[model samples]
Target chain A: MIENFKKRFQKDGIWVLFLLPALLIYLVFMAAPLLDSMRLSLYTGKGYTPTEFVGLQNYIDLFTNPVWRERFLGALKNTVIFFAIHMIVQNSLGLFFANLLSQDFKGRNFFRTIIFAPATLSVLVTGFLWTLILNPHWGAINQTLKAIGLDSWAKPWLGDENLALVTISLASVWQWVGMPTVLFLAGLLGISDEILEAARVDGASSWHIFWKIKFPLLKPVVGVVAILTFVDNFNAFDVIYAMAGAKGEPGYSTDLLATFFYRTGIAGEHPIGIPNMGMGAAIATITFVILMTGVLIWLYSSRKNEDLV
Target chain B: MSRTQKLFTYSALSIWAFVAIFPIWTLIVNSFKPQKEIFSNPFGLPQNFTLEGYKAVWLKGNFGTYFLNTIYVTVISLALIIFFGSLAAYALAKWNSKSSTALYVFFIAGLMIPIRLGTIDLVRLMQFLNLQDTIWSLIPVYVAMGMPISIFILTAFVKNLPREMFDAAKVDGASEWRIYLQIVVPLLRPAIATVAIFNMMKIWNDFWFPLVFIRAEESRTVALGVSLLFGQYRTDWTRALSTLSLAAIPILILYILLSREFIKGLTAGAVKG
Candidate 1:
């Protein structure tokens, strides 16, 4: 039996070697941390120093406790607002640009390149750039507004609780609209020109053709972009963290879920020095579940559509 | 094709083109103006066009070093992704059975799952491996993170490769390894280029990885270095604008020169779903 086992190991050794690196990396890094975070979420304490087996108490507090509950719901509302703004501004603008550029024009390539340029820059860079532009006191935007006799419109966009989230979301939209535009453009190109010509022959208006024909054909690609937007918007951290800092603050106005988790986990309670890894982990777990549900629903819908077809 | 509709389309395209190009133009023009002019008349051309900002940015910031570091990381990562990624993809594609399908799914699962979820443990693992605060730490992570998407694209391309080439190679007593290197690799050039461009832009522009992993200023990539510069001084518009223009110019020139291929690659990658 020993000899047979040794021979089997020797024969399979190369495959084992080939698989070792990826498996080791994934297991050590991906799987273990996720599991650990989930495990951490079950334990609770005053802070980082856990002393009790709370067993979903953190989650319970999240839902039941007013202080935590309000914060949670507020962040959720802001996130929804953020996402709604992006869908309207980013996706709609992307569709508009895609529609415009679908028809040939001089320097079309150059236009595409410039339009997509912001997407290539890091969001951190883009965020900082816009923050400077929108700075209330010394911003070029205000200066331009004043120069053009529109000075009344200028405000501390990032410093106002009311405008901070909206302003930041618009900046995010500007940086990312290129992505969906290109995706939509690709979808447009995939559509047969002959069908569009047929619509033309039928005396359909351009807007009518776009709404009735191309829009329906582009549903799958649109679905993909939507899910992508969903995942990315939820995972968003760097831009907000860089621009608004961890609290999403102008008095916690922009406090996103990711930032909230970060503050609780690592930065600690400002008044308190202790970190609450367990609670943070619980929040992270909830966030992950929400994201996973979104993804799974998307996959199921796509698969069901395929089955029907 | 109605005249009025055509006119509207052209007008819309023109307006968008203006909007897109305007910010870039503003950055460039702003970089050439002195700080006072920039603040006083934000919209006009520079009163006295100067290279002083560029001179200052290059001399003081050591942007050259940042540029070199970015290029090194991006190029090396690209080579690895194209090579190992393609090799693994070819195996997954050619095996064409239940086990390979499982492996394919295993690799592609990394797509839906964000790598940041594993970030805590990854940092610890990097520390344990003693790769913290180093460029080497980024390479493997980037490669591993990038593999699934690269494989997905390359596999699609591989599936479309002409079968006769493989058949001919097989008839000449070529092994699978030989067929992959000799026959398959060359035909994959366009797809590989497409993949390379997409990955290059991601690496060159990434800030999160650098912010988390690279602690030393000496180790900073262009994106991180420039951001650090911005952070140090809150209201230095002249220098900040200089830095922004510096970061953008190289990529701008690249995009302008290869606009067609670059846009093609982007649209192709995105719409593939």
Candidate 2:
């Protein structure tokens, strides 16, 4: 066995050498930090200095303490609402647009390029740009509304607590709708022409064809899109941070897990509270688990459905 | 395919397209106007097109430095990610060992994991390595962040290639390194382009890492620099708009020039995965 192992190692040593650079970097920088962060969650501390090894105390506080629990639950609720908004509004609109673009129309490429253009720009630019447009006084959105005799519809979209979360969600949807649209378009193109032709020969309308044929065939892509949206929305921070600041302000109405984790971990001091690194690490670990659970559920369920098919 | 349906499609598309472009159009148009004109005639054509806002951003805001720092980080990170990602992918694709499957699964699992969750320890590690507040700090992090997807894509690409090509090369007495560098690397162009475009967008627009990792002004990326600008000059719409345009326009131009490839690459990643 020792001689056999030696021979195998000699033969495959060069292949191992090829994998070394990427594996080393990934293990050290990505994988190691993930494990360390989870470990850090076990200890309670003021900052980076953990004073005590309180096992799962931080996680308990995350659920029990009034301030921590309130923020944690609020962030979780908001994160769900954020994901729901994307899944409902963004993905639906993306499908609609993709269906429209899939038609043989003039200027289809132009329209596709224009719609996807915003997704390419930095979130900082998009966030700030929308902030200006949604500005109450002289911004174009309000001004346009006033000019069109619908001044009552205009309000401080990003500032009012009741509307802030929805407004931010819509802004994110606007920027990222292109992602699903393109993915869905690719899926639509992948549907076999023969299947569509048979449906057409049977006198199926476009809407009927889409509902019965295209939508069902697009199930796998839809699963991919939903899971991607789930991960991205849960991990989202930049747009909210840029538009509403670190506090997810207008009273934490727009706080998601990512922003909440940032404020709790890094900001350390604020008017509302002080940062606890242990609590922050705990939040991070929770976010990680939630994301992993989501992806795994999607994977297993999709696989099971595939087996059924 | 009827006239009414075509018109309806065009109208619907036109409206949504307008919604998509309007904010960016407003930013670009307003950036050219003076502050007074922006407030007075917000949507009007710029009566006086000036470079003053761009001038302030370029000269006063030190955006030029931020731009260069971003380019430096992005280029170095892409080079390392492509080289190492393709190499690792080649091994996983061609090697038929039990460990290869384990290694492939290990790397592919990074796809679902958000690297931002590990930011706490990353800061500590950076401090330990004395890489804090330097461009070098972001290089390894970006490369690591990008690896799982790059390797996944490249491995699929490498697997689909004619196996006999590699065997022929091996029989010709070419070293493994030679086979990878000369034979595999050139054939992986399509996958490489896909990986490059995806990584470029992520790295170039990434705001979180730069916000957390780098503190010095000189080390700041353009995205971070633009955010800082937004914080400081929130009310100064003229300069703020210009700064945003400066940050966004280059990538916009790149996307327009390579829209077909970018779309193909992104959709390929989604469909294949």
Candidate 3:
């Protein structure tokens, strides 16, 4: 067997042997499932019943029907809101912390570790922790607010319709801020020390160094981070499900597309015993399209820039 | 740095640190308090702090079983990722061919498409294979899901390595397998570690897979188990808090301990991509 493999390798057969197994598994499990879901979306039927070719009816109903349209648009609006807040808060704070931590200061590592800790845990754990901390009846957030003479500011953050989604986004931003911060920091580190020294010798302040010199150079990394945040936020389910739940509770205030799909397509109390697999697949397809479009646009621009470079 | 700015910087960092960690701190402190007292004064120490919450959650909540199950799934999935991912990555990195680009794209496709999209069929497939309610079911799913990114990163890292190393090995009449196993594998330690740590955190934190696939008591990961505990006692914040603490302690400690490697992996992965 070993001699035979030596012959095959001499004949340039190693790539075939190496790539086959992984590709086979990915094709079967990943590509097949994705394609199968799209195929499933083309058919509509009740649970355990025979199905017929519905063609584009499902897509039409999704966009045209009032109830589905309202909920779908609502989820879209809420998701956009979630992504917007994260882009502003998460990225800005990430840049701020990255800048601050990059400075020569005592206990910087300690602060970095502490700040990055939430990013390590599952969104589930962080969501649960914040839920506990913001429990209106017994949460420390309310306690602190009361202590600071802002007692009226406290509410059941996860339960209030007005605050639930924003609160959940903030929780997500907290868990994921470390990622963009680290990305920005890497970009910061890549800037030459001599360049910074040159800037410093020219009498530029630290703020000027960052805004004028460092920020523009960090644009590529920031672009990558922004697109990542956008895609992840669009598909974000774990934090919302963990905090607000599958129905996107508190009057469906926190209902993003992912959770809405889970409820409508995957896990809700379908009147029938079987799930609405097609409707769920439709939701998943929409999410996939939106996310892939965002990613492809980013990649296209980045590739063009790389070519110019 | 000026003296005033130095002091101001340290002070700002400290305040942010305190704010960043306050939620978990609150969870620990509140876990000891009785349910009645939690609502009254959540900020202060309990008048009669006790071990009742922890004791109840540990014994009644069955966190031990959940922890063991989580460990089994995470460790096995990570092992599969390292072994299978590196082999594929070796071929993709070393063998520059038209097919390798396609193979790379094939794997890259898996990254953009989230695995949950196929839930309708995946659940059916799992049931057909009799893997529902089993921890083993998550292994292939995770391996397949994680393969693309791992291979992508590993290929990039390996491509960056000096070409002379592989040449040196081959000049010694080393077999292809020998070149990969002996030379390439050793050199890939940091990349493998980065991939392992990244995948480990993700696998441990995953909740949707367990909720969708595992229905039995022995199959539940910590995240799923904690969610179940929350469901059981929706109004019982103290018990839920205790369960949360049990779930969070190990991960939080691991984060603090190896944050440098974790951050390095994260930044490299993000920036390069």
Best by TM-score: 2
Model 3 misplaced stretches (Cα beyond 4 Å): A1-10, A48-50, A270-273, B37-41, B44-47
DockQ scores for all predicted structures: 0.40, 0.87, 0.70
The candidate maximizing lDDT is 2
Q: Write the candidate numbers in order of decreasing TM-score.
A: 2, 3, 1
Off by over 4 Å in 2: A271-275
For residues B24-129, write the lDDT of model 2, one tens digit per residue. Answer: 8889999999899898877768998878988888887799899999999999999999999999999999999999999999999998898999998888788889
Q: Global lDDT of each model? A: 0.77, 0.91, 0.82
DockQ of 2: 0.87
Candidate numbers sorted by DockQ from highest down: 2, 3, 1
User: Where's the lowest-lDDT run of ten residues in candidate 1 chain B?
Assistant: B116-125
Docking verdict class for candidate 3: medium
lDDT of 1 at A227: 81
- Candidate 2 lDDT (Cα, whole model)? 0.91
Best-to-worst order by lDDT is 2, 3, 1
Query: In order, what are the TM-scores of chain A for the candidates?
Result: 0.91, 0.97, 0.92
Error of 3 at A296 (Å): 1.3
Clashing pairs in 3: none
Candidate with top DockQ is: 2
